[model samples]
Structures are given as C-alpha cells and as structure tokens.
Target: MIRSGQRSWLGWLLSLGLVWFGSVTEATAQAVPQPHVKAELIAETTAIRPGTPVWVAIRLELEEHWHTYWRNPGDSGQPTSVKWTLPPGFTADDIQWPIPKRIEVSGLVGYGYETEALHLVRITPPADLPVGKPVTLAGKVKWLVCKEECIPGEAELKLVLPVTGDVPPPSTWTEAFSRARAQLPLATSEWKLGATVEGDAVVLLLSPPTPTEELTEASFFPFEELVIEGAEPQKLTRVKGGYVLRMTRSKVAENPPTRLAGVVVTPQGWRGAGTEPGLTVDVPVEPPTAFGDALTPTAGTTASKPSGGQPLGWMGLWLTLGGAFLGGLILNLMPCVLPVLSIKVLGFVEQSRAGRGQAWQHGLVFTAGVVLSFWALAGVLLALRAGGQQLGWGFQLQEPAFVAFLVAVLFVFGLVLFGVFEVGVGLTTVGGTAMNRAGLAGSFFTGVLATVVATPCTAPFMGSALGVALAQPTAIALLIFTALAIGMAAPYLVLAAAPQLLRFVPKPGPWMESFKQFMGFLLMGSVVWLLWVLGLEVGVDGLALMLGVIVLIGLGGWIWGRWGSYTYPALTRRIALATAGIIIVGSSVWGVSAIHQLPPVASAAATQPEAKSGSIRWEPFSPARVTELRRAGKPVFVDFTAAWCLSCKANERVALETAEVRAEIERRGIVMVKADWTNRDENITRALADFGRSGVPLYVFYPPNGNEPKVLPEVLTPGIVLEAFRETS
Candidate 1:
C-alpha cells in the first residue's frame, strides 16, 4: 500500500504542518496581554550611535476610564515603578514624569494619567566599539491601574536596537515621544514665582514672562504629602503683579515650610509665544505677614522681611488693638466671668467705705494682676504656635484636667461665699481690712481668677481681633493682649476713681449676706457646667473621677472649717489643717491623672447619635467627607463647635436644634457635618483657621456648585441660617 514517492511526499507535508504549529505557539506565548493595561518598552529611534544618549520609554496603555498614578499620588494611590536590565557599559537616568491631571474619586483627590502615559528615561552607551552589534534593552515594569477599583499589573518589556556610527532613523513612536516631551514641566528662570502662607492658606504668586489672560483654570500639584489639602478647591484671583492662588493648608503641615516645590498647570491658551505652558516650580516660601501687610504689598514683587520685623501695617494694628480692648470690656458681662466679678465688686464696695485713696490703690493692684496674667498667656500661646501647634484662643478649656481644676476652684469659691468659714481666717479674703498687704494680695488674685475663667467666652469683635493678633508678629500680638487687659480693668478702675459714683450704691446691710449666698449658687452652677464638659471629653469614667474629687474637696473644706482654724490644742489644729491639705492635694492629683489616662473615644461611637424625627442627623466632619459631598454636587453645612464654648452650646440649642432650621435643611437635602472641637482636634483647628477664626462656633455653608464656602457669623439665629440656604439656593 506504500509507494516510495507518495510516502516521501506525505512525510514532508506532516513536517511542514508541525513547523507552522510550533511557530504559532511560540509567538502566542511571547505576547501575553496584561490585565487592565498594556505595557511595552519602546525606543525613540530604530538605531542608536555609540556615545550618544537615546530616549527610552515605558509606555502604558490603560483600559477605558482607568488611570495610573504620578510620582506624588495626592490623597491615595501608588505610583508606577520600573527596574531596568542594562548592558555592561550603559547607564540609565531616573524616569521623568509628565504633568498629571487631577482625578477625584469619591471625594479623594489623586494625581495621575488617564488612558495612556509614557515615562521617559535617558540611556547612554560607552564610546568603545560594537557599532555594528545589536543591543537588547529589557525592563520590568509594575503599575497600579484604577477605575472604580484598582488592579496591579507587571510585565517584562524588551526592545532591540542596532548600534551604528551614523544618526539613527526615527521610529514610528517618535510622535508619541514628542507629545510626551510637550507634557513635561519646564523649569526656567524666565518665570517669576513666589509663595507665602496667610492664615491657613498658602498663597502662590505667579508672574509669567509676558502678559496673559486672567487664568480661570489652574492647579498646583505639591511634591510632598500633607503640605496642602488637595481636595479643597483652590481660589485663584488676579493681583497687581501676578496671580494669587489661595489653597488651604494641610492640617498635618504643622511647621511652616521654608520652600514649596510643585507643578503649576494653566489652561492651554495661557502660554505666550516661545514659553512653556506648565511650569515646574521650586520657590521659597515667604513667612506669614499681618493681615494689614498682606493687603498693602503686592505679592511676588518684593520679599517679605524676616521673623523679627513687624508684619502688621499701622492701620490694621491700631484697629485690632482697639477691638481687643472693646472685646475685653464686654467679656466682663459673660456668664462665665460674672460670678468671679461679683466677688471683686463686693471687695470694691468694702474698700470704698474706707476711703477713695485705698479703693484706687486696690483697683491699680487688680489691674496689674490682670495685665500680668494676660501677658503670660500670650507668651505661652506664641511659643506653642511657633513650635508648630495648631492652637487657638480657649484651647486650655479643651483639656479635661484643666476643666476639672477650674471646677474644684469654683466649688471652693462657692463654699467661701456661703459663709462656711470666715473670709480671712479660713480662705483668701474678699472683704478683709482694705489697707493691709493681705487685702491687696486678695485683690490681685481675684483679677487673676477672672482672667482664667473668661477664656471660654468669645464676645462680639473678640474673635476677629484675636485671630488677627495671633497672626501678627510676637510684639504686636503682645501689645494687643495688653490692650485687652487694660480694657477689662478700666471699668473697675473708673468706678474707684470717681467716689461720687458710690452714692448710687446701697449702704452695707443684712441684704448683702443674701446676695453673697445667691452668688455662691451661681458659682456652683458654673461648676456643674464644667463637670458636664469634662464628661463630654473623657466619658463616664472621667465624670466619676471628677465627682469623687468634688466629694473629697467638700470633705477637706469641712475639716478646715470645723477644727483647722481654732482648737483647744495648737497641735490638734495643725494636724487637722495638714489632713485637709493632704486630702485636697491627693484627690486633685488622682483626678487629673485618671482623666488624662482615659482612652480616646472611638470615632464611630462619637459620631453616632440617637435618631430623632424632625432633627437633622449630623455626620462627623472629615476633609475627605467634605470633598466627597462637594464632588457629588451636594450642598454642605458645617458646625464647628466645642462643649466648653458657652456660645457654641447656646447657638446649637437656639438655632441649629430648632425644628424650623432642621426642616429647611432636610428639605434642601443639605449634608450636615459636625466638627466637634470639645477636645483637642487639630483638623477642626485647621478648619477654623481657614475661615480666619481661632476658636469654635464657626459655621460654614458650601454651595452645590463647589464655590467658596460662605462663613456665617459667630452668633447664628434661625432666620439667619434659613436666609443663607435661600440665598445660596
């Protein structure tokens, strides 16, 4: 059945089929498609000459709507990386990243390239021999591609090129390389740029080489994390010398940076002839100046002075100082300070009965006490701020230990006012012999106590003045604080100076005792409020510790009042005093330590509140959440509040918690965010600074269109809140 010629032809056909099948299988194995992206190593030219530098790129083609990250992947994401396997004498430089587009996903901001990107690197070969030899360039590239979700991919890419003595022919990828080159950021001396920090924003001033149109669309991509809040919309406005871009500073950027390095991208038509559109900038960050100085000098024209120089202009400095004085005068009427001032008033009444000269001396001593306390507080605040702390006025009230101590002190004051013991014999006197040194010391201590208790109240004009004072140079800041001290003491000083004013006061009588007892009740009420604030800060455990301390304090006061002042034996009295002092000191120490050691409240537990009808449920505020809501085109309302701030509590009860406001907010579908600053929250502090405020009770309204947030007044009424929604709508 097998003829010789036929059998040979059949064998040859079978061998041909086997060869073709093997060739096809090898080709398929060499070209496997990677998930989410296609990656390859490409050269700009088909051939390279010896000693000449050649541009090689790792090109990534992503699926639709997918992207890969830049070197600095903003809020989140990892950048694409590559490792090359080069020939013996070849060297490769770092990969150059092109300008990245700002990509926002679920409120998180990222910098990356969509669809496709070319990461270029330059390679150089040694001048020695092998001109006719072909070289293989290989690299292992890894990248993260993300759409709604993220997928990681890796591929080994290889390219072959011939080495020659003549100039190489351009490859088909030449156009791709040219386009990538155009996207690269240019660094040149022609463009003048500068940056300065103002309040919580970093102001960037850009002066192009030639005149250009008002840049409506521009963005700055920082090289480091936590230098700027990437999600917060940047405000760009045209100034005299250049454009000023005001971007919110990151909460994590505690220390002011000396230099700011980033990429600045403008619209396509912004570039002048022969100038690059995008700039890679590394400019020095100028130190912050006073609000007054910022208004006078044009940014980017001249450099700001160093630290020691005065930053505030004359007009702003005087106006802020005047406001501080007026605010301090008004602080006397706040509920928190009223009880303490009552004791000072009683002392003034007693001194006035003695003589006008003695009353005036008491007033001067009290003024000295207030001024010294304010100066010390100002110094500490400045030092802490310089050391990179995001602190503001009333920061001390946020501390549970401090609040507890104030409560204990106020409680003891209440006991004194109740006449449980004689003023001079058992405790510091308020109405002792007016001309004695002891009486003067009591007057000074009263002034100090008043200053300490007044921290939680922010009177009208006080917030803006304190904010400006804190933002200025140290000397100017101290001057403003001094003015506040004088204003607080002025009322008492004038009353003492004009003895004729005392005619209006009733003569000393039995009714004064009832009034003193009533003031004691007021002080006790303040103590209760402080206890509530402590509970909010450290939870149930801290409340228990504070209550136990109060009980111990009461026991100690009883011991001192009963036996410590007088007894048959001097040794018995001394023992009783010692025991009382030990109990008071030990209980205070234990309470403070226990409160400080309490664990932080879980964020989820703190944010969740019981559901209620006709009430707006508030979500805890975070930078990411704000960004997300804004990106979703939803309007947002933010309440920056602290439990220690009486004004904050009043506003919440009177305005925010009202049914009318809630109904309106719900009808508008507004996203309500509560930034609780009851404790030390740096994020909330930074947020307050963004509105040029230094304390709590800040209300911010963000429109659906992502425009600048509208900051409401410190005092909010239901009508005021409803009007804001209507205007924005």
Candidate 2:
C-alpha cells in the first residue's frame, strides 16, 4: 500500500513542470558532455495504404546508467506518455512497453530499461484518405529518466507517412519494427481461456504452454484502475503444470460489464484477455441456511456467465437486512459486549424495585445506541466510498493510532470495572455509578462502544451479505444495515421490554463486585489483544508506549476515584489529575506519530510467499518473474494467506504444515509460493475479489503441464492437501 502524505500544490506543479522537464538531455541527437537522452520514431515504411495497419514505433535511447519508465513505473518514477496529433480520420493506439527490469535505488522502485528501448503503437489511416498524399504525425513524449535521482524529460517527435493506394513495403526501419512487435505477448487469438469464481476473486486458467512460464513477469493490467489496481497483480501460480492467476474486484469498483478487460504480460511482452464468468454473491444464509451455494466448479470448468457486477436487486436488500439483524443479535455474545451486558444486567436488577418503566427505558436507550452507531457507521462508509477512498470493513485496524486509542480506552474501562476507579459517591459497581447519574445515556454509550469493537469479527454470513449490500444502491445498503442493527438489538430489546427478566440477575451485593471484577479482567484481555495487534503493525516500541499509556490512565482513574474521599490531599489530587491528563494526551500523540512513521516491514517473516516450490526459496509474486520461471519450465504453487485472516492461519497450521502435504509437494518438485496479504495489498485484494473470494486462506495447486489447477476447500485437511499435490504430480 502506498501512503500519500500531505503535499502542497506548488510542490506538485514543480514536480510536473520544471523539475520534470529540466532533467532531459539528448542521448543521441546531441553529443553533449552532460547526460544524454534521445528520441526518434521508427516505422515500417514512409507510405502505407489507408485502412492497413501500420507499425509506428517510438524509440528512446538512454545513455549508460540512465533509464526510462515502463507502464508501471513502480513507487517513484513517472511512466513515459505520448500525445499524438494526427490528421482527420487517423487514429493511434497506446504505445506498448517492452518488459522492464525491476530497478531499486535509494529506497525507490521504478520499472524501466537502463539502455535502448522501443515502444510500438498501431496506427490506422482512414480509407477515404487521398492517394499519394503525405500526413505528418506529431506528438510530445514525457518520461522520467532516473539512476539515483529522477529527472523528467519531454521531446517533440514526428513521423511523416503517405496515404497511398499501394503501400511501399521497402523500408530501412522494417527490421527494427519487426523486432519490437515480436517482443509483445503471444497472440491470444490462438489460446483458449477458462475461469472460475471462488468467492470475491476470479481465478483464470490459461491452457496449453503459455508462450512463457514467467507468469510473475506478466502483469494482468485491468483497463480501469477503479476496477483493478494496475500496480499490483495477484501472483500467478503454475498449477497442474498450467497457470492460475488470482484477481480481485477493485476497491473503487463500478458495475463492470459481463467481460472484465485486462492485459496479461509475459517476459516477451503483453497479451490482452478478458474473463466474463458470471459473478453473483452467495445469498444470505438463514437459520435453515437458505442461499445460493457457492459456485465451486472442478478443473476445466467454463464459466457460463460473468462473476461480478451490481448486486441482486431487491432480494439482496432483504438479505442484507436479515444479516444485519443476525449480526446485531450476535453482538451481545461478543467478548467486548459481554462485560457491558453484565453491567447493564446488574443495573436492571437494582432498578427493578423502583419501576418497570425505568428498566424498559434503559433497555430502549441501549438499543437506540446500537442502532445509532450502526447508522453512523453506514454514513461513514457511504461518505468515504462516495469520496472515492478505498476502504473496507475493519478499516480502523489499518491505522495503528485508532487501535492504540481503543486499547487505552478498554484498559481504563477494565480498571474501572475492577474497582480501580469509582464514579459515583458511595457506589462500587459500574451500574451503580451510571445509575446515580443518567443510566439510560450510560447504557447507550456502552452499546456504541460494543459496536465499535465488534467491527473486526465479521460474522460468518456477514462478508457475503455486506459485500452485496455495498454494491447495491444507497437505499438498499441502508436497509441491510438497519436489518443487521435490528438483529443485534433484538435480544437487548426483549430483555428491556420484559422487566421480569431482571429477576435472573443475582442480588447486587458483595458477589456482584467479584463478578464485575472478573468481567473487568475479560475487558483487559481484549485490550491486550488490541495492543498486540497494534504491535504487529507498528513494532514492539509502539506497543511499549501503549502499555505505558494504559498504566498512566489507570493511575489517573485510581487517583480521580479518591478525590471525594478522605484518602488524598487536595494538592495531591490536583497533581494526579494534571499528570493523568498530560500522560493521556502525550501518549495518544506519540502513538499516532509512531504509527505514521513506521515503515513497511519487508523481511521474509513479514512477507508470506505465494507458492511454495520444493526447497527453492519462495519469493514475492511478480507477473514477470512468474512468466520467466514458467518459461524455464518450473512449476508454481500459490498459497494466499494472511496474519489476521483466521481461516488462512488455521490452514497453515493444520494442513499446509502437515508432513504428508509437504512430502507430496517435495516429491513433485513444485515451487511453493506464499502470498501474504496480512496488510491490504491492492494486488492481493484484487486477486481475492477476482476469484470471487471476499477474503483469504485460498490454495491453488499447479501441476507441471501448465493446464488448469485443483482448488482446495476452505477448510483444508492433510489428506486433501496431500491428494492435491499427488493428483497434480
């Protein structure tokens, strides 16, 4: 994921104009002492028949050690772009880039060639053009040239060609144009395509010997960025001796057509292919598990229709509502909600002797809090999605700052419930403290907090339901969210209406204090888990700071609890409060800043390999690299897993690590690749969603022939995994 920090307009303007322009130096046209950069056009002939395809190429000759950009100029460099001015009825297509080498220098990455490079464009002249007439094609080319530092350059290049009845075949540049065309990806017109939708992702199976084996060297560049992240390609694994590319729906995806368009790159060049598997969500699972069963097809299965587009009309809307209701009901059972529920239960018991109206009021207020929170969340998601931000459920976890803040908040609550802090005069239990002031509001806030914590654990049916809801119209999305809200609030609403349920609670006495304390421990446990997650994202240093903040906040709460008592002096109380405020503010700032500064972890431990092949060290999936290896006849196996994705971890521990699976793979001499999507990788996300999988724990086994692969089930067993390798072998 690329982080876009703040930048001023002036900085951007300079980057586009002077800074980028001034860096150019003619490489061949000028024999200057300074660095050289030259541009020229190569064409098959000066004259061609109108309506006949002509190869017009743009060539860039860079001096030693200097480079020009590829289509995907990685992290820092700018790609070479051209603007063509042609006569009426003349059209020019985009320039095709040759395979680029990965260049990393000074912690910057850019795809480019260090030496000579040629980009080809197909030109077609109008059939009505006058015979024997010449037309000049002019264009400005902009490119970023770099070694250690990047320099942007532009050059005006032109090509004069005649529109004649009979085209002249003899040309000095014909050989060069031929070579450039030869470099492009194998013509796909001869190859057959098969694909399947596993979940949110689409898995394309390319048959026969693809011109090249280096699938990693190839990029599946979807035409639309909003439909796919062009920068990141899901690693293509060689399964059953063939290739399987994992692709996803873009975070900012639109309602795409039946055919999803994209370009596939090999080491030699790029070829275009489109997959039109019918995409649809597995309908919501009711108590009786009513829904469309996931379309899991065997090998060589052809998709009858496209897999992704707008969601189901009204049917999806109702399903979403049903899911929301279920989610709401499940919220009460969540670990985060349990503590608050206990406190509410205790409060109800105390209010019973007073009046049922008050008890009912508290329940209503709690339900209101949960529903309101859900609505607010829906608003945020809708607003950000509308603003074109790539966001998902549990987006909060992506920010270490938010996670740290939550950790501190939970710590304080846990401490308070454990009797480390007291809120009301002569009150020990959390309910007593809240009841002393405004019980209903307190219950409401508790409900909101529960919802916030519950975002991470997307219940079983929630992902498919939510995914469908997200793609629907705003009204439908809202209805689904409301349904979930109703589901979550159902149990609480029932308890509120039936005041007699308060009798189920034990009398509020000494034992009640012990129960609250135990519940406090649970809350603290949750805090610890959140802190641990933060540590994984940022580092140990960040976690240490978070722990310190929790301790300081606890001390503050403890000191504040003693303020009205005869325990501490006025001056000491004031000092404690001031110290607590400072620590809280300081820690929050420090934690946020630390997270922002944290660089991505690039170590193997941090990066999970996509396919694990033999003992050969598994590398991160690259389209170009995969293509190269496959060209070399090396089989590839891709394992898409994640740290936070529960199913993935389970599969790794149980099935993947099994000796039988490993032995079978080793015996087959397959290359193992693990694509780690612990963090949000646009490539992986696109790949997953492309395969029709909303999430991870995906396993695709590639055999030696480069045919279709065998996809394993979500829950992998040793036997299943071993059999996959054996069958592929």
Evaluated with TM-score, which candidate comes out highest? 1
Clashes per candidate (backbone, < 3 Å): 0, 94
TM-score of each: 0.59, 0.50
Error of 1 at 690 (Å): 1.6
Candidate 2: clashing residue pairs, number: 94
The lDDT, on a scale of 0 to 1, for candidate 2 is 0.59
Residue pairs in collision within model 1: none
C-alpha lDDT of all candidate models, in order: 0.74, 0.59
What is residue 194's positional error in candidate 1, in angstroms? 12
For each of the candidates, the C-alpha root-mean-square deviation to the true structure, in angstroms, is: 20.4, 19.4
Query: Which run of 10 residues does model 1 get worst, by summed lDDT?
Result: 299-308
Best by lDDT: 1
True lDDT of residue 631, candidate 1: 63
Expressed as tens digits, the lDDT of each residue in 4-29 for candidate 1 is 99999976775454444433332332
Off by over 4 Å in 1: 1-244, 247-310, 338-341, 351-354, 423-429, 433-435, 567-569, 602-605, 609-611
